[model samples]
Target: MNFKELGISEDIIQVLKNTGITKPTVIQQESIRFIKEGRDVIAEAQTGTGKTLAFLLPIFENISPNINTVQVLIVSPTRELAIQLTEVAMKLKEAKDINILAAYGGKDIGSQLKKLKGNIHLIIATPGRLLDHLRRKTIDLSKLKTLVLDEADQMLFMGFKNEVEAIIKETNKKRQTLCFSATMDSQVKKLAYRYMNDPLMVTVKKEEVTLNNIKQHVVETTDRRKQDALCKVLDEDNPFMAIIFCRTKRRADNLEVALHQRGYNCEKLHGDLIQAKRERIMKAFRNADIQYLIATDVAARGLDVSGVGHIYNYDIPENVETYIHRIGRTGRAGETGYTCLFIDPKDQRTLEEIEKTIKFKIPRRELNI
Candidate 1:
């Protein structure tokens, strides 16, 4: 359904129209009404399903323009996700004078402290960094009206449960709580029960891994030969932008170096890189200066890069859900894309799980030497 049918504000509708987001996704259509009504919500939607906008829009509408003492608090698992959410919030360009800031670790605390002094309506932060600010008494969440745990499962996975609990206890007890995750585990459910009031639960069905607009294929090769095979694919396809997923930081770094040595414009992103370097590499990739981005799953998570024409799985993901998140980097916003997975014989079990979860067999493509 169109956003207008949801009774959104005219200003929001105009902003959405300018971005060509005339219609709401299934999750948005269902959750927007409840969120607008200021209800606690538990939404389960896959990545690349426009879930970010689903919660942000309602928060924007409900915010009071004059009183801006951090009305909305969005906690993300990674620094990259926090930054991405802030960017999305900025795009709203609400009629009210609202300031949205993102705070994360590994950056100069001085800059973040300076931004905190301003009138902030919304603060998107990572758990560790947010707690650091809380310890310094720099952030005042006394006026917090809504608290969102975006990618709740990932936060738990990252071992931020204690920090998250601490942060929640600091907020107003009567505040509204919202949680969104691609997959929910027992711990995640327990966290919700402990923190959230009687909340409405919404689960958006997981679609098949292979989008109709994307062509998914696998190339079987040994670990030693995977780079050569990837090079061959790049030579043949020459995609405008491609994201190569490695299993670990070392793998990503090695792949990046190999690609560079071969005279390809490539960058590496992993947890090892400093925040500034990661940001610079991401900027280059976004600006189309770097055609290839080799990253580990953690580093790539929560990145909202656009125009990625191809996704290469240099190492098969350990879990089926990760596979879904990996391939999702491409074929976004109704754009046609390509996904290729380098599968070794040892990864058969993981491949089977992925196929079962997605309910489709990935087509196998033989490498042409």
Candidate 2:
């Protein structure tokens, strides 16, 4: 359906149309109406389903520009996701003089404290960093009208449950709450039951896992030969942008070095890098200055990068869920993409598990070294 029919403001509708977003996705059409009506919502949608704008549009519409205190608080699982949410918030620049800030760990808290000073309308933050601000009294959530837990299941997996609980306790209990996740584990369900009112539940059915639009293959090689194989694949495919997921931070760093040594523009992202450095690398990658990104699962989850033509699993993730998240980087928005997995004999069991989860056998391709 058209966004105008969904009761969006004329100015916001103009902005959306300018971005070529005339029609709402299923999640947006279902959730935005209730959100505009000021009801708590729990949404289950996979990545790349246009969930970001679904919540952001309604929140921006309901925001009272007059009130200076933090009216909307969004808690994300990672610094990358927090930055992405802030970017979406900034896109709604039609809001008059609204100040938005993102707070996360591994960055200068002093600078974030300075930004929190006056007339801040929206705050997007990682759980630990938000708790730090709450403890320092640098920000107050007493005026909070809306609370959103974006990627709630991931936050729980990352062991931020206590911090999230503490932050919620500091906010006004009467505030409207919204929770969104790809998979709702029991922990996420319990949090919703405890914090949310009779929430409207909306779920998008999981799409069939298919490689029709995305060409999938495997590179069978030893650990030492995998780097060279990756370079060869890139040389052949010539992707405009790509993300290579490794299983560990050290491996991601080493892969970045190897790719750079071979004269490929690349960057590394992991939990070890400082938040500022991570931001810089992501910015470079997004701008196409860095064509290849080597990342670990923790650093890559919840990132919203479009036009990624290639996704290479430098190492098969231990769990099938992570495998799903990794390959999800490509084949987005009906675009043709490609994914290659570097698998050794030892990883056969993991591959089996992934196959079981997807309920389809991934086609195998033998690579000539």
Best by lDDT: 1
Model 2, CA-based lDDT: 0.84
lDDT string, candidate 1, 283-305, tens digits: 78878899999999889887767
In the range 73-110, model 2's lDDT, one tens digit per residue, is: 99998889988887778878754457887788676758
Per-prediction TM-score: 0.91, 0.92
Taking every candidate in turn, the Cα RMSD to the unseen true structure, in Å, is 2.3, 2.2
Clashes of each: 0, 0
| lDDT (C-alpha) at residue 353 in model 1 | 90
List runs of model 2 lying over 4 Å from the truth. Answer: 17-20, 94-96, 109-117, 208-212, 366-369
The global C-alpha lDDT for each of the candidates, from Candidate 1 onward, is 0.86, 0.84
- In model 1, the runs with Cα more than 4 Å from the true position are 94-96, 115-118, 208-213, 356-359
